[model samples]
Target: MINAYATLASLVAFAQDRLKNEEKGATAVEYGLMVGLIAVVIIGVVATLGGQLAELFASVSEELPAVTTTTTTGG
Candidate 1:
């Protein structure tokens, strides 16, 4: 019917207006992109330095002294 068509058209127009006026959705998308970029940079840095960092830790561990534990009983 013609009435049904009119109702559908009005609904579509309302949806279009809401989409145009909305800003929160766009801001959330931008923040998500920034976080993804930061994660990628962190992963790249860790991958590049992983081997050197491991070697540095190994050298430091060699320079440290061993631990000795003693237990005493008292009555």
Candidate 2:
């Protein structure tokens, strides 16, 4: 029973050591951060462009001439 306990403990310790010494999870974390940064930048660009485009379209709408009517008399 004592030998079995020691073996189990050793296996657990080995697993913990491997997990602690590993760099495998760091790459995934780095990639996630990069993706988040890119999303923020995209959102900022869209907000700026959307505001400018709305202003431009509003100006264009105002410049369009309204319909008119005229009458002429012949003698």
Kindly list the per-residue Cα lDDT of model 2 for residues 16-60, writing each as its tens digit: 675699744345655565566567656767786998989998987
lDDT scores in order? 0.61, 0.60
Off by over 4 Å in 1: 1-26, 66-75
Instruction: Tell me the tens digit of each residue's lDDT in model 1 across 6-69.
Output: 6546655655675789733435654565566567667767898999999999987776543212
- lDDT assessment of candidate 2: 0.60
Clashing pairs in 1: none
Candidates' RMSD to native: 17.8, 19.8
Instruction: Report the number of backbone clashes for model 1.
Output: 0
